[model samples]
Target chain A: MTIVEQPKASGTTGGAAPRGALDAAALRADFPILDQEVNGHRLVYLDSASTSQKPNVVIDAVSAYYREYNANVHRGIYTIGEKATAEYEGARARVARFINAPDSHEIVFTRNATEAINLVAYSWGRANIDRGDAIVLTEMEHHANLVPWQLLVQEKDGDLEFVPISDDGLLRLEVFEVLLHLKPKLVAFTHVSNTLGTINPVRQIADMAHAAGALVLVDGAQAVPHVPVDIEALGVDFYAFSGHKMLAPMGSGALWARRELLEAMPPFLAGGEMIREVHLRRSDWNDIPWKFEAGTPAVGDAIGLGVAADYLTALGMDAVRAHERELVAYALEALPRAVPDIAVYGPMDLDLRGGVIPFNLPDIHPHDVAQILDRYGIAVRAGHHCTMPLHERLDLAATARASFSVFSTNADIDALAAGLVEVERIFRG
Target chain B: MDDLYRDYILEHYRRPHNFGVLDDATTSHEGSNPLCGDRITMQLGIRDGKVAEVAFTGRGCAISQASASLLTDEVKGMSVEAAAAYRADELLDLLGIDISPARLKCAMLSLETLDAALADLDASASPAAVAAEEPA
Candidate 1:
C-alpha cells in the first residue's frame, strides 16, 4: 500500500516559490530518504531535532573512507594510516572552524553531546570546583546538560540551582541574576531548548556568568545545526554539540573548550594515545584535546562529520536559518488554525525560537497524536523530550514536537496540519 | 475509522468505565510505561474469593485508556486466580485491533498492573510459603 507520489505543491505560501534563501525543493533531493513513501504517502520527516537525515555527500564520505584508505589513526607509519590520521585531525580542524574557536587543539572528539558534557563535568568540575561552590543551570536544559552537572555538584558537595523559565518559556533574567548572586563556580545552560525551542542570549549570559566569577558551558546540541555559532565570539568556556543532529552520522561529536582549560584539565579516560609515558603505577597524560580522547576513535564517522560541516558551510548557515524560520513561521500560523484548541509552547516571537515546535491539542495525548500522524507518513517526536522537569513546569505530561531542517518544505507542514485534522476527526467526531 | 483507534476505543477513552480508586480495595498495584509516560494504578475489591470490583486511574493515549476500561469490565465478576491467569492476547483480541510492536506496552499496561496486584495478594497470603515455592 505504498503511494509513490510527488508531495503536494499547492497548499501553502512557500509552495509556488522558494520562501527563503535556499531552494528547499532542490536541497530536499540531496537526502535520499525524503524521496521515499511510507504507508501510502510521501514521507514527511519532522523529527530532525531527534536526528537529521544524512545527505548523499556525508554518506559517500564515510563509505569512501572505509573503501579507500581504512587504517588505525595516530600509530601506524603506513600511507593508509597517515591518510586516516590526516582525515581524522582534519575533521577536528573543520569543526573548530565551524564554531570559530580560537584553536583547533581545543576540539575533543566525543561520542555525543551528552558525553561531551560528562567529560567537562568530570575532568574540569572535579579539578576546580570546591565543596562550598555552587553550579547554576536553567529549567529548560535537556537531561544531557542537566544530569551531569547535578551528579558533579552532588559529588563535590556543592549546591545546584536552576534559573526558572517564565510563562512564555523564556528564561527569567531577574531570577538568573539572583542565582548569579550566589557566586557559582560554573553556569551551564542550553543555547536552544530542545523542548521549547527558546533561544537563550548566549553571549549576554556568558558575560554575566564571567562577571560573577563563574565559567560558562553552552550545550549547542540544538543550536549549531540551525544557526551560526561563534564559540569565541560568544565568550563561552565550553561549547558542545552532536554530529548526528547536523546531517552527519552518529558516534561523532565535538567539545570545544579554551586551549588553556584543556591543558589544565586531567584526561577524562585513561588508555592508549592519551598518555605520553606509562609506568607500572603512574603515567603522564598527553597534550591538549588528545588528552581527553582516549583509545581508538570513530575515524570514519569523524570524516563524515567533516563533510557534513563542509556541506553546511557551502550552503551558508544564514541561509539555513532563514529557511527554517520561514518553515516555522508557516507552522506557527498553520497548525493552530487547522486544529482547534491547540496549545503551543515556547516564545511566540519568531526571533526567539529555533525550528522546533512543541504543542498539544485539547484532551489528546501526544502519543496518540504522534501515532495518528504516523499513519499519514508524517514523523514527529512525542514525549517529554528528555526535559521532564520543564514538562512538569508546563503542567504537561508530554508534547508533540515537529522540528525542521534544511530539507523541510511548506508541503510537509501542510501534511502535518492535514494530519492533525484527521486526528481531530478521529477523536472528536 | 482507523483500525487502532476504532469508535469503541475512542468512546472508552473519552468516558472510561470504573476510572477511579476503590475505597475498599483489597489489592492495588501501579505500573508505568516510562518511554511514553503512560501510567496506571489499578485497584481491586475482593469478596468471597471472587473479584467484586475493579478500578483504574491513569493518563495515557487512547489505546492505553480504553484498554484499561475494557480490562476492568472483563475482570469485575471473575475470580482472583482467573484474573491472574488472564493472558495478554485475550485483551488484544477483546480490543478487536492489531497493535504495533511499538505500542504493545501501552496495550498491555493494564494487564501488567492487574498481574502485579494479584502477585501482591499471593505474596501477602503466606510470605514463607511463597518464598519456599521458588526454585533456588
Candidate 2:
C-alpha cells in the first residue's frame, strides 16, 4: 500500500496521495504553519528554495522517534537501542533505494549537503589532488560546492577551473568540453542552482567527466527535493543532498558515493562509532559508511529522513515534478503580469529549470519587497542566497526569490502577486 | 512608506547618494558583506576635524541602503571620532525591528565603510600637513 493509506504520520507524507494523493488543500491542512497568518493577511509561503514546510507525517515521524525509540544505536545491547539501530540502518536502505544505489553501504549520513561535500573534499580530495592537476567545476555552484574544491586546490597544488553558464541559465557544453580537455583530477557541480533553479544535465555531465578521467560529484541539494533521483542511472560518482529541503528536519542529509570509490577514500573524521577497535596508538576503521560517519550520528534525524523518502515515494516523483512544473509555469505566467517592472533570473522557459524564480523589481530593494510580501503574509527569500559567485557573474548584488513545492497553489501565487503590486506602489511612491 | 527603513532608503537605493567620483573628498572607502552580496562605498568631505559632507553609493538589500542613508544623517556634521565609534547595535536598534543574524551585516556595511572613510581622512590629513611644513 502507498504510505498514504497508513495513518498520516508525518508532514512530508500526509498529502502525498490524494484520496490516495492529498490535494493541495488537504496537504496544506497537514502543515500547521500554513494555517497561520503572517502579517494581517493569510500566509502565502513561497520560500521552498530555502527549506520546505513539513507535512504532519514528517513532523510526527520525528516526534514519534523521540517518544518511542530514542536511544544510541550499535553500542547498546538494549531493546530500544536495537530498535533505533534497525530504524537508522533501515533509513540508510531507504536512501540507497531512493537513489537506486547498488548497496546501502554507500550512503553516509551527514549534517547537510555542505558537510557531505566537505567530507569528499577532505577525504578523497586530500588524497588525490596533485601538482599541475586541474579540478573542473561550473560557475553555477553554491559556495558549498565551490569553496571545498578551492580549498582542495589550495592544499593540494591543483588548478580550479570553471565552465561558463549561458544567459538562459544552463551550463555551456562547449565550455565544459574545453575544461574537460584539461584532464582534471575531479569535477564537481550543482545538479541545480538553488538560487536560479537551473537544473543541470547531470547524466550527460557525469558521462563527460568520466570520459575526462575525473571523478564527478553532483551537489543534489536542489535536485533531490524536486524530483526523484536514480544515481546509477545518472552515473555520477558522488551525490549530496539535504533532508530539510525535502521536508525532513534540519541537521540531516546523506552523501551517496559508489561503493568502490567510498571504500578507497579515507575516513572523513576519526572518532567514536566509526572505529572498530581503539588502542591508544593505531585504530582500525570500521567498514564503508560507518567509517565516514565518525560520531554517535543523527539517529532520529536519519530515520526521519527515511520517512521523508517514503513520503516522496508514495506521492510518486512524476507527480511532484508535474506539480512543481505547473507551479513554475503559473508563477512565470502570473507574477510578471502582476509586477511588470520585475526582471527574472535564470531560464525564462520552465523546461530548463526547477521551481525557483529569482527576480528583482526595478526600483525597490529585494529586502523591502520581501518585507512587504511578509506584511501580506507571503514569504520569499531575498539576497545572495549563498551563491555569490553566480550572482557576481550576473552583476546582481541580490534578488528576491519565490520558490514553489507540492503544497503551493495558484492562490498562493495570487497572494504573492497582490503583495508585489503593493510593493510596486510603495516603491513608486 | 513612512517607515524608518522604508522609502527614503529606497530613494537612495534606486538613485544612490553621491554616486560618482569625489576627487576633492578628504577620504573614501568601500566595504562589502559577501554573505548577502551587499556593498557600500562611503565618501566623506572632511574639513578641520569635522565631516562637512558625507555621501555613499552602492547596491544591496533595503537594510543596507537604509543604513547608508541613516549613516549619512548620523555622521554628516560629526567629527571623524564619532563616526568611527558608531556601533552596529545602536544602528540596528534605530531600525526598531528584529532582523535575523544573517542580515545584521547588511545593515552595518555602510557604517563599516564610513568607519574606513574616517580613517582614510585621518591618513590624508597627516600627509598634507607634513608636505605643507616641508617648503613645498
Candidate 3:
C-alpha cells in the first residue's frame, strides 16, 4: 500500500461518473491502428491476444525517446545519458507499480515473456534444480511457458509432470494436487490459456505449490492485458508478461521475481552492462534487475511500455475487464446462431475464462475458415496457436480464434458473426 | 470474391476427387504440415511402368485438399518415373491462382507426399539399412 497511488473510485456510490470508466468506442480513437480498413472492409482486428494494436501515446512515447533523448543508460554523465537512464528507470518504476510490485528492482526487462521464462530457467533453475528433480506444468500452457522448463528438466534428467486439462479446457485441480504430492521443485503454468481461454486460479495454485515446498512461476502474457493482476496478492514467486500484448511496442517484455530471489540468482546474459567489476577471467555482477539485463536494452520499447501502462491505468483495468466479459458472453451465444453447428472450446461460464475464444466450423478446417474470414477483413487466428499440447490433449487438429480487447465491442462480435456466416455459406453451401 | 479463387477451391473441397484409400497401393507415405496439422496420405499403384492407380486419403484445408484432389487426375496414367519427378512449381502453377507465400506449402503438400512415397519406394528396393534414414 506504501507504493500504491490511485484516486479512489466512488462509482459504486452512484454520485460521480466512474473513475477510469472504459468507453471502448471512444477509447478506440486512442489506438491509431484500429481506424483502418483491410480488404475493402473495416478491419475487425480480433487478434489482440497475439499482439495488441499500439495506442498513439505509446507509439509517440517510443519515437520521442529516440528523437529527444537517445543515449546508453548508466554510462555517460551527459544530459541526454542521464535523461535516458532516468526515463528507463522511470519506466521500470511504472511497470513495478502496474503489477503491484513492491520494488522496481524486481522487474527485469526481456525481449518477450518467452525470454523472461527462459531467464528464470537458465538463471534460477540452473542454480536451484538438479538431477532427478520434479517439475510440474499444466497441459494448456503456451509453448513459451512450457518449453523453457522442459529444456531445464531435460538437461537435469528430472521428472516432468503435467497437470492434465479436461475436455472443456479447464485444469483438473485434483490432478494438480496429485502432481504436487510428488514434491516437485517448481510449478510453472500460465495464468490463462491462449487457445482455450481458461483462467486458472493462480493464488490457489500458488498457495498449494508453496505448501508443497515448490516455487511458482506464472506466465501472465494473456492475463495481464485483460485482467487486473497483483503478483504480491497472487503469492507467486515469479511473474512474466509481455508489453506487446498489452498495447506496447514489440520488443518490450518483463520478468518480475521477488527481490530476494533476483538478488540470489545469477545473471542471464554476460555483456557490457550488468556487471560491477570485470577482470579477464572473473567479473562481479551488478545489482538485482540490472544484473539480469545484459546489454544495451530496448530503452525506446521500455518507454513505450511505460506509456502503455499509463494508458491502461487511465482506462481502468476493472472496466476493461467488464467490457470484455460482456463482449465474450455475447460472442459465445451469437456465434452458434450465426453459423449452425459451430463449436466453441473453453469454459461456458464467463467467470472461468478471459476474452479469447477459439472455435470451429463443422467439417471445414480452421485455415479455410480463417481464409474466408480474411476476405471480410476480419483477422482471426487459426491453427494450433502455439498450444500444441493443449490441442493434442483435446484431440483437436486446430481451431480459429478471435480474441477481444478494450477497444472491442458488441459490434465487433456482430461483424465476426456476419463474417462467420459468410464462412458457412462458402464452405457449407 | 475478393479476387480469390474460393469457388473452385470450395468445389474440390466439397467433392474431392479420388479421396478414398487405394486398395493396392505400391507406395504409401503420409506427409503433414506440422504447423497447421494438414496431413495427406498419398498412395500410388504402378503397373507396367505407369501409374495404374492413384488415390489419397487425409484431411486439411480447402487448398490442401483441393490441391491434392486436382493432382490425382494429373498423375493417374502417367509413367511412375515421370510422376515421381513432378516438380513443385508445376503443381503450384496448375492451381490457377496466386497462392500467397504463407500457403505455398498447402498447395505443394501432395507433391511432397509423392516425393516421400518415391523415397520410401527407393528405400524398400535397397538394403534394410536405407530404411533407417527415413524422415521422421
Candidate 4:
C-alpha cells in the first residue's frame, strides 16, 4: 500500500514539509496524552469511542478562547463578547457545514450527545408523541438515546419498540422493516453501535422510516467521530453528536433538525436566553435553536469543537476514514491471532462497520482483561458499556472494547494484541 | 509493572469467590455502578442477628471481585452494624494498592450491596426492634 502523507496543520499552512505517511511514530506525536506512561508502559489510548485525546492544536484553541476572548455571547456590546459570539456562532456554522445542514439556525449547542438526544425527546417527542404512539429504536442504541425515550414513554403513555440486531451484532433491518410496517410515530437509532462497532445502514433506514411517515433521530455519537456524514444526504429529521468523541474538549455537542421540525417543536428547557419574553403568567419562546438552549451554553467547548472539526477537516474526512478503517482491519486480524480463544463481537466484515473492536476472552471477565491491558498502558473500556439491552440480546454480561481514532495506528493495534497475549498467559497460569 | 496490578486481585478475578447463586440465602440484593458497569449480587445467610454466611456473584473487574471476596471474609460472623460501617478507605487499604477515585466504587460494591440488604431488613422490620439490636 502506498503511504499518503498527513496534511500539515490547517493553521500552519505552508510552514514545513508535510510529514511522511502517518505511521505510528508520526501520529503518536500529534497526541500529547500518548506520550505519558501508565502502569509503567507508554500510554496506548484506545478509548476514542468514549472520548478522544485532543491534539495540541485543539488544546491551545480551547485555552486561547478562555485567555483572550473570554466573554458572554449574544448579549454583550463589547469587543470581547463580539469576538466570542463570532467564534461561537462560527463553530455552529462549521458544524452545520460538517453535517451539511441547510442553515446554522438548525444547529443547537448542547452539553453532550446525551443532552442533544434529550432535547429532541423532550421538545419534538413531547409535543408530537402520544398515548400508545410507538417510538421505534434498535437494540444497539446507547443509553443516551434509549433512556430519554423510555422517560418520555413513561410520561406520555407511549409504546417504545426495539428493532433487534442479528446474531452477528448488525442491525436486523428486516425486523426494522416489520416495525416500519406498523407505522411508528418516530424512529431513533445509533448511527454506529458503540459496543458492537456496527455501522448501521442509517441512510437506507431513514428513507424507509420517512416513507412510512416516521421522523428519524440518529445518535451520531459514534459515527461522526470515525466517518464523514452528510445530514442532508442521509435525509434524517434529526442528528446528534458529541465533540469530545472527535478530539475536542468535553461538554460540547450539537442537535441538528430540519427548519420546519425545529420551528414546530416546543422549548426543551425554559430559562433565561431561551425565552423571547417572560411574564408571570406565560412566556413566548425564542427562535428554533435558542429556544432549546436554556442556559449559558458551553461557549469555549463550542469554540474548541470548531478547531477540532477543522483539525479533522484539514486532514480530510476521506483520509481520516481510510486511516481508521486500516487500523480496525489490522486489529481484527491481529486480535484473533494474538488470542485464539477471543470472541470478537459485531460484524465480521471491516468494510461494513466503524472502528470499534469489542471482544471477550473465554474464562476471563472483561474487567480483568481490561485491567491486564492497562498494565501494558493500553486504555480500553470494559463491561456492559451502557448497551445492556444489546448485551442481553447477545447473551453476554460484558466485553472489553478498544475503539480507534484517526491518530490510532497499526502499532497501537499491535500493543492491544500483545496485551491480550499477556492476559491469556496470566489466565492460563 | 512492579506488581501494581496485584497478583491476588488477578487470582480472585480469574477464579472469583461466591461465583454462583446461594442455595440458602435469607437475604439477597443486586447492585451495580452504572458509570463503570461493575455489578454484584450478594446473598446473605443470617443466624441469630449476625452474618453467618456471606456470598456474592456477578460480573466485574479485578478490584470488584477482590473486594467482594475480602468483604465476605471480613463480614463473616460480624453483626449487621459492624459490617455496615466498613469504610471505603479500609477496603482499598486491604487491596494493598492505590485505586483511582473513579474505581473506588469498583472496590466497594459488595459492601454497598450488603448495606442495601441491611437497609431493606431495617425497612421491613419494626423500628424499635431494629434499634434494640444495634451492634456496639
* Candidate 3 lDDT, A1-429, residue by residue in tens: 111222222211112134555678877887788788888889899999999998777888888889999999999899999999999998898888778787889999998999999999999999999998998999998999888888898898888899998888888999998888889999999998889888899999999999999999999999888988777788999999999999889989999999999999988899878999999999999998999888899999998887787667666677778788998899988998888799999998899889999999889889878888888889999999998988888888899999999889888899999998887876776
Off by over 4 Å in 4: A1-25, A277-282, B2-59, B70-100, B113-136
lDDT of 4 by residue, B34-129 (tens): 655678999888888899887888877678888888778878899978877878777777788777665677878877898897776667577876
Consecutive 10-residue window with the lowest summed lDDT within model 2 chain A: A5-14
Best by lDDT: 1
Pick out the ten consecutive residues of candidate 1 chain A with the lowest summed lDDT. Answer: A1-10
Expressed as tens digits, the lDDT of each residue in B15-130 for candidate 1 is 99999989999989999987788989999988988899999999999989999999999999998889989999999999999899988999999999999998888777787967
TM-score of 2: 0.91
Worst-scoring 10-residue span by lDDT in model 4 chain B = B1-10
Please write out the lDDT profile of model 2 over residues A1-429, one tens digit for every residue: 234622322222222344234256667776788888765678888998899888777788778889998999887899988998998998898777766777999999999999999999999998888888898888888889999888888887889999999877889999899888889888899988998899888899889999989999999999887876878778999999999998878889999998898999989998998889899999998998999988788888898788788777666666777788888898898988998878988987777788898999985668778877777788899888988888878988788999987788889988888889988887687
* CA lDDT, candidate 2, residue A309: 80
- A1-429, model 4: which lDDT tens digit per residue? 122222222332112224333344665677788889888888888899989988877788788889998998889999999999998998888777776677989999998899999999988888988998999998989999999999999999999999987889888788888898778999999998999888888889999999999999999999877777777778899999999998888999899889999898888888988999999999999987888888788899998887787666666666677777888888888999988888998998887778999888886778778877887899999878899888878988788899988778788889999999998888677
Tens-place lDDT digits, model 2, residues B8-127: 566655665455556777788889877666778888887877888877777777778777876687777887777788888888776655667656777778777887877766665687
When sorted by TM-score, best at the front, the candidate numbers are 3, 1, 2, 4
Best by DockQ: 3
How many pairs in model 4 have backbone atoms within 3 A of each other, for residues 3 or more apart or on separate chains, i.e. clashes? 0
Candidate 4 or 2, higher lDDT: 4
The lDDT of each candidate is 0.89, 0.81, 0.86, 0.83
The TM-score each candidate achieves on chain A is 0.95, 0.95, 0.95, 0.94
